[model samples]
Target: MAEIVPDVGFLKNGKLKTALLQHKALSKSGLSERLFGLMFSGLVYPQIWEDPDVDMAGMELREGHSIVTIGSGGCNMLAYLSCQPASIDVVDLNPHHIALNRLKLAAFSALPNHSDVVRLLASENTRTNTKAYDNFIAPKLDAATRAYWDKRTLSGRRRISVFDRNIYRTGLLGRFIAAGHLLARLHGVDLTEMANARSLREQRQFFESHIAPLFDKPLIRWLTSRKSSLFGLGIPPQQYDELASLAAEGSIAPVLRQRLEKLACHFPLRDNYFAWQAFVRRYARPHEGQLPTYLKPEHYRQIRNNVSRVKVHHATFTELLSEKAAGTVDRYVLLDAQDWMNDRQLNDLWAEITRTAAPGARVIFRTAAEKSIIEDRLSPAIRGQWTYLAGRSQELNLQDRSAIYGGFHIYTRTA
Candidate 1:
């Protein structure tokens, strides 16, 4: 059997345990589960509030081109569908995210109408929605997903009970965020109110006063130093260590706060839907508005049809890339997965990326350092075929949800 690393960082003695416990309480989950357990603990979805304008600005999504991407929350996958790609192949290691993506596609495909789909999935109308799930969604689900929603929690409510609950903070990252909120609250700071700020200046002032101070606490600083505390955010231990290594002083929280601060301070609150998800458990909805643009009426049919283009499995990027035919994919969205790689893994991934990418194809991903994550680490032959657009990535990166990331990179394969 392949190695399954139990996330013992949570169980490490006192200070870390307390921080983890606090985050769990705030995210609304009672306790942190093992990495695999965390994936299956709930529906585990990211609120689909991606900044589409930022994602599509520089790239040209031509019709009839196949694209391969990492299905983080599956938001970007749907967003890309709006451009009408010939196909999109989405991959992820987490089964919870896979189930959530499948459910979303099913909702788009089988729901009676656009309005019904929106009300059932986006709006808070669960009492009537269960009928929709049963009639349209339930029968279509494979056994695993059907069982996931049917399974009861300790309180005797099914996991589907989250439909009526504030599910924004329900996923693995949500739990970490919840924990961060609680730890901040322990020191007398509340982030929930930041969502109500009427102006950008007001929002900036609030983050400066409340959210920024938590990073200064010695206890929080110490806890943030360890890579394992980040598992709740879906960052494995190796990525955490790489991200921490970027800091000259070996401190990560301040650098992370700075990047996040840019997301909160520079961008308009109305456009920054990611901020809305992090601070408030919801986004602004027009009276009977449709779902996010990616899930809109126009894109639903195509995204559902393209659903088979995506395949989810438990494997690393290198393992998956090894199976691709040479010169196949046009776009690769890594999303900082390389930060988890050792030198060999990094070499293997780039070798595959180099082998699989066609001329002018783009490979985009984020990292934990301001510099390119592959500097001096990749084989010269593999690295030479690519041109990294550092400047453009820096510009689009200001819109990313996790302010904790170091940098975003877009590399184009050349002949």
Candidate 2:
């Protein structure tokens, strides 16, 4: 594999610092924010959490629609290709995410077949995956992306070797889930038992018998009281506050319990891959359970054919939007990022969204709180340009298989 000195300066990247540091250096919130920045600097979401099916439906995606979205783990962008979007401009502050998105595009274009791509990306088989990467995917990657995968870790393993193991088991989210399993084990609870639930009743029974009791433990309650404890879930200080606020007594334990319950009981384990990832630490096999929309077999050909339409950039969404001509983009997927923004950041983002949105453009996002984050934060003039589809947002939020978010929002550019 091609090699280079590993680039580890992403934690200090100015854009990330500016976005995450909203408090004083010595303050409690500031320290939590810094910790989150450090954790988020590395690969965070091994698999993006937002449900692409809900996203596509909310955007009302149409053939040839131009889209601009944050590239977290790159799943939704690939899924959008199945809808035949004309172009997708993906931006992220994390360089790792930029590289991951580019790598996925290359894998789709260069891998020999759907099965090879699936094994390399969605499954664990180190030798075959590493061989496939060296022979096929590596040559297709851009210089920057190839370098990212080829760089050696502290253990001296090439970054691409993650695919040889389980790539989903290596990132911050993966570590978080693993930690959750460990915690449950310590409490004599087998969280993975939720996956064995053959029906909704069994799922609820397992949750009540096993998962629900963990939150009531004194240790679990104390640990969750700290805002920094949730950085593993990619929840920064601001969003943590929002989640805590949802609980009647300001305890995040109840909030977490409710979310986990929705994840476990709202959908059948056989159909909800989000539940599978939560309880099983990986997606189900092809014959075992449903997969993400992008990973489903029927969409493979369309994703491959449309892979060339994606362009990945390492930048903030506002920065990327400022460069676009007015009335250019037709769809926007914000992915709960607004939860991390303050009033100024929210206004600035809406300004760009309003300025660049084409007629009939649709914007969809999620919130950590039960209501829209932009309710009164956005300046009137900019906010007036869009209509909030409250009914549609609620309907879609209910259908979101990844049931972690408190709310899903949709805003359409006013004619």
Candidate 3:
């Protein structure tokens, strides 16, 4: 079977590629690094885990805003359309992700109504999605993207069959989530029971009682301590190192414990589709209306109306930024891509971003480590162009329902 992700060469020649080769070699051995590299090379996050609502709050988009964001699963880009931005340029190195973003826009444009759009994306019967894609979306897509989804997978099924089969359940994160459920079962915990908990108090009780104890087990500690075991969670070797550095003890288990606690207990489950996905592995019952902001019924009209505001590219953030004229971009969402970059790459990206940023333009990103990577790695001249909104960033981090990233940063153009 052809792999869903063919390569992780988003940054072709650099320290990043060197690290990828080392990780790929490690993958040849049966541990997690190979899987992480393979997954990183493909569609990893079927549904992005970041909190778009928190991102929207921080962006404070005005009518004239033009934003640029990394298109992971294309969820947040769709969510931001509701803010009525003038235009949004969504870029990613993964062609599949660019296709996903394109598919979303086409669906919104072609579907008869909002409910049909919801049924196509959120419901289990992929026939709805497949038919929708064939009759509605396919004609609108560029030839390259259409061919991507039309290509058959290992099963002799067209890649679009993924949507028909519950796309959210397919991808590296999906398989990883399935593994987590399996792990929980071995420890006498039912993740679904935690998912269906009636209240936040019940949620907290379940985590403390049923889930928390599992982290203390020898097996989990052993698994999580290895950098390879976390590939499903989309942690590259560098990210794993950053996460490991957060603790003086260097045990990822404790960090995992804390993040899981937040995922299970921090927010109202009725409202947090992220938690439902973590525990139940699907969005909240479609009837109950728990979904990502982009999938919510209330925002459907605005999103569909504004879906045209987005333009997608299979390109890196720096490459995309370098093409724009100075002082043109107003908002940026980098989504942990910085963690993958070395100092030279960081400096190059920030240089373009600095040149392209409009007055008061804002950039937000997540980090695998708790510290701001730009502070130490970026040249002082490039870094000085932006002011770190440290207090607000930390506050947003606390409220992030995804509860996985170590830090969420917000930086504003100072001049």
Candidate 4:
């Protein structure tokens, strides 16, 4: 195992300060270093991306197309495999994310049955899972993962102890949400009751009472105004800037409040799975303890089989895209990743994207604002070759799960 060093200076006095200072027009090098710091400090998570069911629907993905995706946490890639893609390549800069992806693949590959896998991951309780880990998974893990699982935190248990709790809060964005909840609580707000509202009106009332007070706080407003501070929320600095810029006086609280209001009030609590994860810490479960639609029992075999079709690599998008032969990939799921790139990186990435795209290949991704990042950002020559399906992408989006995403987009290489 590589000996990990604690660079306390970076967190307390380094690029974090630079990021906060130049929140709006963060340079490429600054953004890269900040992201690397986030990855190293474990502020970036194994699973901070949005639900893939929402993403796949937005992409309108069909069978027999290969995809390339950023593997923040492995959940979405597994979700994509359920649709029977020809292949998927999961890329990440964080080794921890790769470790988590490998763990998911290992579980699917070696679990005794689908039931055991569910009992471990989907259940949110790891008692049975720890037993399963000890008996089944622990011995099989590679040295790195074994060390990750074995390392103890200040709480005395291993980091693997997180599986027993609402482990969603362990991720980068999850930690931000947890902190937000704490801050909200300090202001006499309780987010959990947004669930008990019986109607849209009731939901509105709940938010007004329970969620709105934090937005009024000076500290919350100040922190919300800065884009780079939101890296803790798993938002890239660029995307955070765009979202912040959309509001009057560059106040982000109103924007976040409005979007979160939509997530909490626009749909039934039982149906809005994002709210379930956010407010209640678990999704509504049937008596049999079934997972979400994208993670049904029957998909396990297919996911396990298609697991081989995907490879998780710890590298940047440009690095991986540079190695692939032109016209080899059929689909690309960028998942709002482009918002993190600077002009040069964007150009390099799209250059490879244009070169690697097969005829009629589809590319899908989300953004932090309600426009395609590729439109103004990509070179005109490259952008002209890919036809954007503006009308189709809008129709596929579900308002409930996707309230936080700026917008979903799908593009196809010109035939």
Candidate 5:
């Protein structure tokens, strides 16, 4: 496959606008959508929120399987490399994500060893990571990806400098987490205390004593009520409505509180990297906490050896599927992108998914609501070809350590 150079002009090209602008310009929803597109056109997720363990289990990924997934933050895509898939095609509309994915592949191939890879990707250090990039990774990158990292920010720091300071703290999601910490500090709460909890009981106690009460604050409730406040979470207006609808009183704060409680109390801090990122703004060291599968030392050699199997594309899932032969792909991971789609987009996406999926192929996606968003929205003709794994989806949803999504859905092509 030839390299598809990323078109950095996302707004000018109108791809993002077409996906997000569901209401008329000048309307309240339209302005919110436009604002979200602008914010999302750049990097959003510094680390993807969906649980890859749940994804691999739901898909039942096997050696030599052909997989296609959205490349958010590139963690899960690298994690999937451990499965030794024949091919992993990653699709994303964001140019920065395309750059990031390509950079990870290059780092795996070019860096000296596992610890160097970990230091560059997972740790926050004063060590000159840029030297590692210059001496090793940069030369291995394709011209487009190399340029992306070399590009200077307003501060004049090279984009790759994020690795030195803490790449996890650099994206929109990172800024959002920082802002949450600031808000909590103003209320005399240090959210990082959740990370100090040594047991589930202590976790729950911290939440009940310090975190849970914030949801009832007049200011917190008011801020969450507005749609613009959640763009950092990558929740567009459409998804925000779905999330807000889940709250019995139509307030997003309670919904947020519920999710936070699960994130803090449902999983042990020592085994959940998602919790570490949420509370501490960086991953825990190897002995202190678990790391993402790709970052784990045991899997490092396997992922590095298989990095060539992964490919990143700057395109939509439906668009990419349209170009593939029927019955070619065995697994699909959509993340939460479906929550942002309209009915027509949903139907078009499923139409191609059904066409391109191999028999017994699996599709996994996350949603902002507990119910499957496509349950009634997809046209029956397109929807009937696949069976929804409701029980299995619910089972896996409970196991997802990320604790952010309201639903995790699985569909298997049967005909």
Candidate 6:
């Protein structure tokens, strides 16, 4: 009764209007259904991409402001906890994501120390992770989440046992990253060398020398052209079309190349854990002074203390907001989910957001294209309630350490 998947149907608790079925059809296609089934079926994200540091910069959260965000890998939830929000509700359509978030919270509560937690999550030493999970985390989970990680795989080991191998390289995104590494190796590139760069200049030099040429390879060009091939980036058919439209010369390859270049070179390897996970397939070592905020040692005690302020739900963002009292939520992070909605769905979502937003409430989201249709999709009467911060959005977008998205937008409810 908790999980939700909007158009591909697996809804529970809330129901869409019968009249909106056409909008569902317009938004989700046959290919998108099959892939979305696959994407939502298993673990979709091993980490969240919309940078928390950039998001925090734009949100400028007040003391005790309630925050709502979409939980992907649950990394940013922990990051947000560091800011000492009054409460945080993280919703997702995937039940597996719900379980993962619970597991992370459980780990923070039950683990003996921060290193155990880092090793468990950073995918560094896999041998003891399952034991750690069983010993520290299992007794703390709810029945459904417990049944999820406890379910036996075909190999006769617990499903959670995958972490004991390489959880980062296991999910859809992980498999996609593995494929990219395979392709890079064939072209005589070593993605792991990205971990060694000491400066932005060295990062750029390494990328130009080692990684950038792979994009021009005919094999790579052919692979990137196949939309099915990008399921790892978690792009649905609708979002793929958005990228196609935004791409130069009507090709997604160039857009992806530019984004990958940004991921590889825009930030120092020592601080950009997103780049480390992309190229090295693991987080930077603790000694390296590079990590997501939640993973760093200095923040551990605070995250541990504030972890209880977070609650995870397997539901759509609108469903969660619709049920909340008016003027209750102040900070919202959409995490690019709006890209999947059609015009009607977009309007429906915004209607609920506008209704629930407190005065001066801020909303942040990413888009596959640099420009979004919010101006057209939403009537001026409805849209007038919020002011979009174009300058702030662009400024923060440039500083996004992850750099996978095309646009990052911030909007505030003015009245």
> What shift in Å separates residue 187 of candidate 2 from its native position after superposition?
0.6
Ordering by lDDT: 5, 2, 3, 6, 4, 1
What TM-score would each prediction reach against the true structure? 0.82, 0.97, 0.92, 0.86, 0.97, 0.92
lDDT of candidate 4 over 205-260, digit per residue (tens): 88877787778789889888766557776676567777966778767888888778
Q: Total clashes, candidate 2?
A: 1
Q: What are the per-residue Cα lDDT tens digits for candidate 5 across 278-390? A: 89899998678888878998889889999999878877898889999999999999999999999999999999998899888999999998999998898988888889999
Tens-digit per-residue lDDT, 1-415, candidate 2: 1221225454658778988789997998777788889888888887899999999999999889999999999999999999999999998877788788888889999998998888888886657888888999898887878998998989999998989888887788899999999999999988877777888999999988889999999989989998877888889999998998888774699999999999998888888999989999888887779887888889999999999898887778898899999999999999999999989998998899888999999999999889999998888898888899999999999999999999999999999
The alpha-carbon deviation from the true structure for residue 172 of candidate 2, after best TM-score superposition, in angstroms, is 0.7
For model 1, name the residue pairs that clash: 23-179, 27-178
List of clashing residue pairs for candidate 5:
none
- Higher-scoring candidate on TM-score, 3 or 5: 5
Give lDDT per model, in order: 0.66, 0.88, 0.81, 0.70, 0.89, 0.81
Clashing residue pairs in candidate 6 (N, C-alpha, C atoms within 3 angstroms): none
Off by over 4 Å in 1: 1-53, 248-250, 287-292, 296-315, 399-402
Model 4 has how many clashing residue pairs?
A: 1
Q: Please list the residue runs of candidate 4 whose C-alpha ends up more than 4 Å from where it truly belongs after superposition.
A: 1-40, 198-201, 287-293, 398-400
Residues 204-275, model 3: lDDT tens digits: 999999999998899998898888888887778778888988755646898888888988888888888888
Please name the candidate that would achieve the greatest lDDT relative to the true structure.
Answer: 5
Write the number of the candidate with greater lDDT, choosing between 1 and 4: 4
Query: For candidate 5, what is the lDDT?
Result: 0.89
lDDT of 1 at 213: 80
**TM-score (C-alpha, index-matched) for candidate 5:** 0.97
User: What C-alpha lDDT, on a 0 to 100 scale, does residue 308 get in candidate 6?
Assistant: 86
Winner by TM-score between candidate 5 and candidate 1: 5
